[model samples]
Target: MWYSISNLLGFGADFGPTTAAGRLLTIGFWMLSLILIATYTAQLTSFLTLKASKSTITGIDDIKNNKVPHSRIGIVIGTSAEEYFLKTISQGSTNYYHLSTTQDIFIKLLDNSIDVAVASGASAIYAINNLYCKLTLVGEPFYATSIAIDLPRVWQYKQSLDVQILQLTESGELERISAKYFNTLTCGSSSSDESSSKKMEVQSLAGLFLTYACVSVIAILLHLWLKLKRHL
Candidate 1:
């Protein structure tokens, strides 16, 4: 049982099996090895053929330290993103260019008018995946906040609205709605194709193929030796 397990994992025994049961185990080992080899080859081939996208800037620090001028940093007017950057990144200075909408943010980026933009995580990701194919999101989220409905203090339906919102949240309706929008903006198919084309290279899988070739040659030689011994 131990020998079978060890061989199954590709750790061949030093001595040949002498008993019928041991030989059977050895056969099982060979079968497992062949399956593993085939599986690895297929995966390696796919990996070599796929490409990856590379981003120039990875985070807010990159934007801050980048030699790009301050005017190139875009911020949507009257947004939390704008407030956050003004208070934290820009240090109370209004050096960034102002834009009225999220669409304008991506348009400016595509035109090279803005080197970077401060916006909500969801908005940024949506634009990058759905609107601007060339844009990429990088780094961890800087500020964490909740999305909630705001109401005036004297609103008569506030209690009813709160109860309904709570019900939606607890019943998973809100999550489903959010997922619908997220799925639309994921951009999986296009990004995958673009990445596959960019990253894959023949040299990446050379080592895997070399190892497989060496193993195949050894197996062939062993089979020939066994055939000659049977005849003698």
Candidate 2:
């Protein structure tokens, strides 16, 4: 309500809940972590899905350059893709203009504010085949992550659930769901993008070198000006 209060008072304010804000927020993290763990155990993990409202774009290049652009790709915060994008694409900064939550990204795409959403390619294909065929999927997927269901770490009582998941997998029930949703028998292997890391490292070194050179030049100029002033 701080944002509301500030607006009422004619002052700009940010009201993000934080430790300073005194509201509990870790529950979301815990719940998400629990879900991931369950998926891991049951092997029914959720896949990330990228969706776009507009249909004209044809390929990943269009999405990366003309459509989504570096400053406008939307992704779920704290997700695997976000982490990879930061490390490989954004150099570990959380403030990439291209990134946002999956939902907000879709909304942005619908509003024509963003070009595309980055999500599980599997999920994207599913949406395209079953739901949003109007939007075209770009080139081959850039990466893939294993999908799994979250479960508690305890190995005793969850055995029954594990057995059930295995039974479903063997009975082809899980495969049916996969085919229905994913249009494939098995998920594709994740693409290996090592160039991103190498490029980031190179850029970081260049930035450091440039900063050091700039500071050195400034210091030399200042010293020279001070010495001449002393004589004058």
Best by lDDT: 1
- If scored against the real structure, what TM-score would every candidate get? 0.56, 0.45
lDDT of 1 by residue, 76-135 (tens): 988888888877777888878999898898899889889878777575666687767777
lDDT by residue for model 2 (1-232), tens: 5543443344435654454212222233233345545644443222211122224555555644545456556667767777777666657665544545455644666676755666664665665545553344556677778777787787676888879989998999988987776774232221211101121235534654565456546655666776788799
Residue-level lDDT for 85 in candidate 1: 80
| Model 2 lowest lDDT segment of ten | 190-199
Q: Give the TM-score of candidate 1.
A: 0.56
- At residue 214, candidate 2 shows an lDDT of 60
Worst 10 residues of 1 by lDDT: 191-200
